[model samples]
Target chain A: MAVAESPPSDPEAPPKVRVGRTPGRLGNRVFQGISTASGIFILIILAAVAIFLLVRAWPALIAAPSAFEDVGFMLGRDLWSWVWPLLFGTAISSVIALVVAVPLSIGIGLFISHYAPRRLAQGLGYLIDLLAAIPSVIFGLWGIQWLQPLVSPLFTWLSTNGATAWLEENVGPTIFTGYQAPARNILTAGLVLAIMILPIITATVREVFLQTPRLHEEASLALGATRWEMIRQAVLPFGRSGVISATMLGLGRALGETMAVLMVLSPGYLINFYLLQPGQHQSIAANIASHFPEASGLGVDALIASGLILFIMTFGVNLIARWIISRRAEFSGAN
Target chain B: MSKRIDVNDLNVYYGDFLAVEGIDMVIEARSVTALIGPSGCGKSTFLRTLNRMHEVIPKAYVTGKAVMDGQDLYGPGVDPVEVRRQVGMVFQRPNPFPTMSIADNVLAGVRLNNRRISKSDAADLVERSLTGANLWNEVKDRLNLPGSSLSGGQQQRLCIARAIAVEPQVLLMDEPCSALDPISTLAIEELISELKNDYTIVIVTHNMQQAARVSDRTGFFNIAGTGKPGHLIEMDDTTTMFSTPSEKSTEDYISGRFG
Candidate 1:
């Protein structure tokens, strides 16, 4: 049994002092701390952005002077009027991206981890890591040039024959819908986002799959199990939480992705359930990124205010993902 | 009744390192055979070679024939999967699947192989397998809990239950009771003796008395050098191996003269 030796920190615990500062045991950690200043500075900058956003958006946060019909107290425009559409689009598109990305990413991770030869697996892992490290702006530029035509043929085929009766009724009335699709739409944006985030999820999942105990696998194989069977029983169930955490990490990125969505999705102000509709349904990040450069009057406050909402949303998502990652070993438990 | 193993000039290797060399022994069906040696003498490696469990590592290979009844086990037509199905193994360390419940751990081999048995039949298999490993009464009420939740000894028994669930002809146990407490160790020893009544049991252990007490026959393997591998020194009836005759190295090992 693994007893919790300290329920919390034990009150009777002896006082301790830093080992590096001790007379005889001084080491390289102290020397390294001096050169790591830039690393420390980056954390401070992240903190500064959060604090600045908090302080600047406080007026809308406290309450609008007009006491606007803002449900979220987002500056000039009422919250429901402006924030909801962007928030909805951000959530819907990211979720759709997650739904598309997760299974395929896991499949890719599984293929590379279990199915590939050693050198090939290593090469694939490096490739995926390189893809993940590529700057977001590059993917956004690529998406604009690449994603539109990629999805056009499939969209055209589906609207033409796949949904014929529904298409016949709605095609003429909504010409820019799937029937006369302009191609740069929510799904196109989502597919692009899915591609961008695939590497991140796959890396996280692949590492987890790799960490599965060799002994458990050997035990399975010795019991007359085939390779696939060994993985299904021993590797998959053990790595399920790891895969969930990885997918959620990618979802957090997808939620806040700005340049790609803004470029690929021609931003407008209509909210429609039809995913293929060629219209403007902006994301929170894209809204802030596009509007912040030239802002005046209440629009500045509104933009900053919306940015605060987004910052909070992303923070909440990240917090949950961390919680999930931390609890993963517990869910799998110790073998 | 299905088979007996005759290992002749057997050698075990992990990459370029030959871990065990020139082992010659016969393990009788429906009886207990113990391989005992000091740490790093390659006793466990030889045990692993009996069912080809050591082949899991990339670059790990072996030479010479391990004949089971009529067929050479390492021959071209023989399948490692089928060999493993017939000759199951328990590791030096207990390894029950952490994500599965105790009942599910017992059913893992059958379930993963897509062997369909009714849920009631699965329940019966769980009980019988656990009973076979001498773990059922202790774990019966908590069969639904995760296998990792069990105490170390119970977890080891769960692994043993998992090994026997498919009902193999031979059981290869590599220090199966090494990590257990005396009570658990006693339980496993009892379980081994009972299992030998029906299955050909080959166990490897550094515990000298364990080999003397449980085995019908004992084989001694001794290592020579840093680069060179261990060789099987002698095999005889357990009574003679412990009491009077054998190789000087075997006598030195058992009498605590030298490793």
Candidate 2:
């Protein structure tokens, strides 16, 4: 082997090598500062919104029944009495939407991620994402114009044939019973909300399902698990916390939805179990959106107070979702 | 309880492309058969074909025959699921079901099949399988912990325990210790040596020394070049293959010449 020649200047002295610093140091600092500012900006906006709502709603929050006498619907009702019904409506409608949507989304999500042909899966995924892009107001229009008339006969049949009467007789008339025609009821609003939120939940679920580690899936298959068994063993468990957070995302939308509930439901002011009956319930967002325009003085404050409640409900739900997700992480295989 | 495998003129394909061609070999029962090769030479693909796991990839298929005992694994009406039940596989990476506890992962093959086992039987199976895999002492107390909690080597052994919990006749390992540290590699190699007494084992490895240490018989697979189908170059007792390979290319490969 031939020896390489060395530089003549470094024969008797230590070599001097330039230690160059990383390039674009200022750009990196600016980028980090911008990202950190953007993150803090979200907190600032959230806090500002909360403060504004509380300031506007404070008067109505302390108002007596006489102060709300000018409020057309549910007149002379105190803040708690009036807000409780709206809160009940919000919770029930969102619950109903989730009950109907979660399983369907899981099925569709699994189909697109695992069962469908590759080409078809791509198309179905695109279609579901497109559904999410549709405006909520259009969903409201479709709910009232198309879905309401379509379900009227079925509602009429159930009411007339005593199909749901047994629920009243047995379980003391929980929200599951009391069918009515015209289909402009809380249940109809809920079904429409279910349809509206289905795409959001399904999209999240599909992405999570698609992200199931290929190695884990192959391991399950190598262990002799059938397609369904593999899904139960690998796919579902991997996506459990993901699905809960996805459902919560859907619930957040359903809880805060205004146009769909306002347009589909005949708003009422009492907490009741007659989900299939019109004029039986009203969610907070729909209540405010409907009355905010005509509301005057303290009535405007009351609507803002209701909006504050909706804000808190959404916040509470997200907190609960994070809690569940963190709890699941303790046992999750992903760690 | 273990089974020997007979492969006759097996050709593996991915879509229209032939990945491996003209493979003929017999794997004996109750022994470890190691397939050694360079990267992308189809040794791993051949390992997957043993359990019909190759078909899990879209458009991947195999032609010709792979038989275990008296049964044709690729015959019509032979469910791949059933084939997999009898011939379990471990990947190059450790992959225990993430959502499952150590005990549940050990029972996954059986429970995933929807077979019913009593609490006592399940406990017994977990203990026996873990003990067999040489992982019992480390994880016996944390059987309820998520399987991912184990170290890389222990996770690989947990995967081994999971594969054997179903009591498969054959266990195919594809570079089972490739991702592990030196100590973990030794642990898995020792486990493989002991496991061959009860189960027919086929392993694919890049490590020639590992093949020499743990395998009774060794087969060399090689590709002519890129886009060419990989073929089985030669097979012999591990001692003979490592010392004096019959094929020039096998000797060149073993002697650290160009792959």
Candidate 3:
């Protein structure tokens, strides 16, 4: 079995075995080509969408201010001025969604992954997955009909209560002072988005928490650490990046969510800090859906331009998430 | 601070299945005791029962008495956490906290207990514990680096430092060097001998040579069949166990016959 021995010079000697070369099989080449083509197709589709958005939005980018008269908010204002408030609305609502969803997601994730009994964990996991599968339109209907009325009294209390008067007078005159009836405000939209993204973030966080190296957990426990202490030492740190990435994904969904915000938020075009006020905020996706039917000429292009802005923001958020995930890879202990 | 352990009629089980049955033995203080057996013989399960670490697995429980210093470890009022604080364990793999710095990892056992030490005292403890594990000289310059930055052997030593930081009375190592290279295994064996001066140590090893090299006393475990529970075949001084074991099965196993 000498691999490197020279081949015999005899005419009857058998062919020497070649160890390194793989036979060129048709099936292998076909499979490799299909997978490579599929990967490139995704990038091509992404680029094509970007190109389409830019081409469709070019007319509004250079249109005269007078051309926007049909769209009441952009009558005399340039595109940037009209879009800035929408951009603010998008950011504020999504930030609220993130701030609310992250802590709750971590709690629920840990409960399912570590705290729940074996039978209960499986049942709760399925329930959360079902929540994620519920349609956005159904959530929109539930938000407008159910959640809006339920939360109106709390907003009214904050606006008119004696205990909150000081907060309105000294701290947030614009933010907490104004309260409109029916509770169809940006804050309500944010709350609905929070509910929408809860299951998504919880699923990711729970999966990462469950995947924590059991040895690290035992190491903590062997040090006489309590259950909470063991989670603090081993579970939380390991799932930190996972939580951030999950938050970013939720942010992306919130930024582009149309039905819930459109149905829950009363439309307005203004840059203000009045979170509870009905006629003070409007998100870009909601704005486009509401105006697209009545828009004409450059008005349509203007809405698309606004969509381009939202597209860039979500893309940027995803890029940041990827960077954070890769940066933490070195010490993730998963190696 | 080292303490002896005495066990009687210990039976380990996972749910309805018994894993290790009818074990009775005494482990002397300030000495190394090695348990050698083939895979699935439940030697590691028996080791975990000493500190109640077996109960960490859902439905895995132990029945019997493991007494140390006139206290039954499995007594009704005793906390498993308190037992683990006295009896520390090292797993087969080296697992350092990935997010912690080298200095922080060395202090993990103390810090995780919610103990507050002053800055100077914390620094002194880190240096002393790392030195005790023979890792201070190699890592003193980069205390701020992550624990995973070290080589595998260094990380294992760092785990040893983390364990000893709490000043446990007994150390249980379950095949601590099975994943390591020969030189690393030698270093761990030498460290084990030095460590016996401060802590009662019980180690489960698949390698009989490792048992012969480091242990003062040895126990051989064997299983009757695939589904039957494992039991201790024989226990004696390491020299006698390797040279003139009383059980026929122990001799056959040691002589590389059927295990």
Candidate 4:
């Protein structure tokens, strides 16, 4: 065999060769550095959005110096009073959706992961993925055109039969059999939002349920526990933290949910006691989307300011969720 | 305190492929039976079949009878869950429920079966089980600690305590000491010997010395060739199996000539 090749060198000069050879390990270090750069890129995008929202909404911020002056506080009492009503409407409708959606979301998640067979579960899971992919505007159109008619009577039943007893006394309206239906009400809009956010919550929770360690299930079942008992003792305990995280994620989605709330809520300008009574019940997101096009100078700023609030609310929720899961990393990492 | 098992002409399969073939064996009451085999030999599969734990896999199954305490364990109406309850299992690596404390781990079986007891009774059961597994003295002061906090030996012993807490008639151990250090392995072997006084113990072990040290009887499993199903080669008293004559195949296996 030929001796290992080397470049021809001058015999008179001392041989000079490569120093500090990296032992072929530098390639792995380079690959790791490349991945770190991509990870940092994601962080950069998030920081940029936060900073941009802050800058754009600075003029209309609640804490802005210009937000002061009893002049505006008095005005807040008067015509410019759309803020509280909208805030109230947003809070009320989102709360309504939370009540209806959170449990249903978790139930759907568990059923898909545990109760359904492989093909049916996969098909259903794919349908949920499809729902998440649909835009909020398309959801809005579908809600108004298709869903409302189907849901209106159920709303009527809930409003009348042993339902809304609180509504009668609280709203200063006397009880009547079939008086008036706030068909385009917060109740209507909330139901729409619930349907929209269901897929999000279900996806998060299903991922969590599926991520539960297989050893845990085997260990539980080997104890001679019935399936339900195993789920309750082993699956549920391990899943509690994941459920909370999923709920937070769903809550954030609901708080910022827009077009469906806009198209269905029958926008109002008053923060009334009767949610179904249909006064000026406009959610913050709905309010902005509806009015931002019409607002002039500071009004546009004010809407951006409201957008800022929405952005912050959503951001804060996500931040708290990330913080929580870091402390208790129990949620399915894929979610 | 012991219960017998009759695994008759059992064939284990995953989906369509056979894993073990024609395993006919009877495990005596209150005695230790060791299954020794080479890699890919189906000793672990046979051990899992005893407790019906093979059902966990989607298509894994047994085609013959495994009668526990004279009840046809694979009868049409026999519940696998109930079989597992009566015949408990300890896996290769100690698997105490991570969410539970040491005491809770021991009580897990009873709790899962919804067998209620007073708090005082539960504490007594915990102490008794730990003492039974020779783990009480090491763990008595810290039963509230997470089950995973114990050293490997203590964890395996805690698992033994957990398995015995249900008062199982049979315990199926699948290479239970394979993941342990020599010291832990020794501890487990000693525990198995004492354990056999109450529970019928079937252990699948790669270590022939361990099989010799702990078992009353030994069954040697060997494969025919690559991708061929495993079958029992020989079964006899551990002493004769180790010291005296047997089939050429059995002698070859015991003598480490071939497996």
Candidate 5:
């Protein structure tokens, strides 16, 4: 009825309802469409990359001589070799990096956020962040030229007196049969990775720690708690999930790191537990980097297959980190 | 375990800035002393000094002495942590540890000190403290629930329970009922009266009616001008202070003439 009445009004009068000519309305819709398109575009690009990797990797697996001995298996070598050693090396080195980085990051984060005076904290925080800006190749070069020489004595001592002694005493000499202590090894590679990732974890965790409410800290102090006790009771509990996600972020970087591991570690095919020794393990990214230029025919497909695996591993680490963060959301009260 | 507090010529400062100056008062044992003042008059600052909580702020310092029982709280060898343990505090806003449960919140003061309690003893202490705060029946069945799940007034009472669980000689409250509704404010006022029988209570409040209703003695604090340090204007019995305050500023402040 209203529409019929409006049509009967004077023809010279402006229309009762405004059309799509309003700049504010048109601009808002256009901006919204752009944002939605950008989000969808990102998803499409990610999917395309995944599908491309999977399609390229399929030929290497299907061309294998046997089903059980193909690229499907993680432990064999006959043209389409298994990825067990690369996977093992990646896992162990990244795990070692996480073990070394997490505690040290938390300690540094706490010192910067809570313990240090304001000016010192600012200066220390800036210095730590500068570490993240250093190029990966530079870290690799430093690890090889300087870090290796410095750690050689410590590595020699460990091989003679540390876990090496216990392993030889209990498990026998079979394990160390082919082990050779080279200057570059998985341990050195992992140590370099740890230093590379420390800044990321420390920066993230320190921001989280700083976000802890002042009231909670004051409440803990007013309860007769010591400074350390107050931190444990309030700051640590509040930042627990943040710490987990920060460590996972560092782990993700360590897992896919190519150049630094390549420069520091002497690559080999077999997985060896003698981390202090050299010529033992080869991470997937480092292997792919070193082999990609010379690779031909199915060899390229094999490198892509290894790349696919590394991608999945890093993706899984990030997914788990997100899950842990969401699970802790209810208790964190950060909302 | 109540104790009298003797504050002599107290001066509080944050670095070069004096926050409050020349506060001398005798806070009797087993009674409530209400500090009533306008905002920025440093009533809360003076209350925090009683527990050494003011110095928690960076560069904050206090001079003079607060003698509790026979011990000087500001003595060179005295530990602030020990002073805090002896004199507990409830803040303007209820700040229950969001990560802790109701039971754990009550036990925080004891547990944070690294003093272990038997399971049965912990349960008993929780029940006793909750009962003292008048929050036992409402929360007893849901002791495992997070403390943040409670209403604003309930959270404040839970904080009170946590403070009293340590069995402090004195309890300092900085406008404990300011964030509550009228009914909750009345409930806390009643609780304060009951609490004074066991603990020497010092409360800072902007509410004159609350001061009149709950306190045995009332101290009025006022600032001279902007950027000037706050000072205590007068101290007297609650009845005298409300009806016939010695200072004109106290009379003006109490009667809503001016801050």
Candidate 6:
């Protein structure tokens, strides 16, 4: 059988190849290149920003403020003196926010997805989404003006009686100020942060819950499950990983929140465990926002260092979230 | 443990649109009754009403009476949940809870009802139910694995196991083998024969041969025209219905004349 070969390479004659452009292929290649370049550009910008923050923080990290002479740890001596307190404050407040936000968010999500009437469900979902659109600064103002006053009495009572008295007796007086000061405190800031992150967690969880396959829901119902029982048996188990990821997303937001914490909490340099006492704590983001404008060489670098820490924290949270999701993917049937 | 079902002048509606009208039949205790019909004939809808599952659909409602052992399922103050507990159902698709283990899937119905079962009792019930469904030998070693890890046939069997674990008096199966292969379909048919010894079984199928092979009684449903409500054309002993149906439409449907 004679094989049809490409037209014998005519070197002299006009090429039979017809190398004229094909718009579809050329456009596809151009679009592919554009997309790849954009992706790499994002990575480059992220790396550049991270490197810039590190370089700016280095000088302050090595300066060793006068207060560092009293501290003995190697890294503590080299880093800014207030770094530990700020780190502690950041972690505690964010954790407090998570503890407060997760349950409330899951409850709201379940109510909207499973219990509410169709029209009311839609309206409630939209209203919750609208909460996410509210600016952080506005939340800060609300926390300071309205929420602080509303909850001040409770804070005062808690600090004076209940667990606070027991904690003071056991842990010592130096640790807590016992609510003698104003209501602007880490507890208030954490509460505001919880409110700020609630919408995000609720929306993500609601979407996940809604995606529970109708077939599984029917299966549960056919097994004689009540509405709440069906949710527990089918919907909750199906959405477990989604809820964890959503909580992590909220935690990430809470970790980076600046304006709300800065506005609501009365900042201090000393490390204190009394979260209900005002003028006892300072979160890294809030400290940076408060001190950055007036800060000098070392102080500015210190702020940048704290910013770098915050970035690492959020990154760590996202990574852990991804790990948890991937680990549960096997049984979740979400793969 | 099985109970006879009496359905009288039943009419099912989705909002104002009647889907199935004037369905009257009796499903004898401890027998497999097969509902055979063409697509869009409301056979599945009629089957769903047996366990009050039809009303779970938005705007769906049913009229008339379906009584089991002299108790009206739709009587005033009769709880749908209680009715469903006594009348278990299997669907066309195999939907074992994807997140639950094989053993857990079997126990789901009982546990979901908040019934307290001792560990030994639960283990015994799981083995018994799985064995009864003819799936124990295949899945006994992997009871801890996710239910979704099983094949299509195995999952359907697991669903049957789940239903029987609740010890329902009647089992409603809607095309339990349509999605399965020929071999799996045969397996399910054999299992249905065994299941009917303990539970009243009502199954809806499009496969006429399946009805001929497994059912003691057969029902043929048909629609008058497009957008018209479906109604039961004829129901009789399976052998008589397949060989000498009373209605021309039943004969035409069983003889493959037209849907």
For this target, which candidate reaches the highest lDDT against the unseen true structure?
2
- Can you write out model 3's per-residue Cα lDDT over A205-318, one digit (the tens) per residue? 999899898988999998888899999999999888888888887888899999999999997789988889998888999889888988877888999999999999889888
Q: Put down candidate 2 lDDT per residue, B61-107, tens digits, no spaces.
A: 99999989889899989999999999999889999988989999999
| Stretches of model 4 off by over 4 angstroms after superposition | A1-48, A55-58, A61-85, A163-182, A239-241, A269-275, A319-335
Query: Over the stretch A1-335, how does candidate 5's per-residue lDDT look in tens digits?
Result: 44555445678878769876775887899999999999999999999989999999888757654533433223347433457789889998998899999999999999999999999999999999999999999999999999998888777776676466777878864333333445688888999999999999999999999999999999999999999999999999999888998998899899989999999998877776768667778899998998888777677888888898888888988898889888756567563
Q: Write model 1 residue lDDT over B132-200, tens digit each, in one string.
A: 988999999989888888888888889989988888889999999888889888888998888888899
Candidate 1 residue-wise lDDT, A1-335, digit = tens = 89878655777775565544666444566667766987899889989988888877766565554655432323345644677788888987898799999999888988998989999999999999999999888988887777677778887876666455476586643423453455777888888899999999999999999998988889889988888888887788888888877877898899889988988887756576557776657788887888777765555666777787888888888787777756645448454
Residue clash pairs of candidate 3: none
**lDDT, model 4:** 0.79
Model 2, docking class: high
Which runs in model 6 stand beyond 4 Å of their true positions?
A: A1-31, A63-81, A161-177
- The DockQ-derived docking category for candidate 1 is medium
Query: What lDDT score is found at residue B78 in candidate 6?
Result: 91
Among these predictions, the greatest DockQ belongs to 2
Score chain B of each candidate by TM-score. 0.96, 0.99, 0.99, 0.97, 0.99, 0.99
True contacts kept of 5: 0.67
lDDT of each: 0.83, 0.91, 0.90, 0.79, 0.90, 0.89
Which one wins by TM-score: 4 or 5? 5
lDDT of 3 by residue, B196-220 (tens): 9999999999999999999999999
> What DockQ number belongs to candidate 5?
0.63
- Model 1, runs deviating above 4 Å: A1-77, A163-182, A318-331, B69-71
TM-score of each: 0.85, 0.96, 0.94, 0.85, 0.92, 0.91
In model 1, what are the clashing residue pairs, if there are any?
A268-A280
Per-prediction DockQ, in order?
0.62, 0.84, 0.69, 0.48, 0.63, 0.62
Rank candidates by DockQ, best first. 2, 3, 5, 6, 1, 4
**How do the residues A112-169 of candidate 2 rate in per-residue lDDT, one tens digit apiece?**
9999999999999999999999999999999999999998887776665554576667
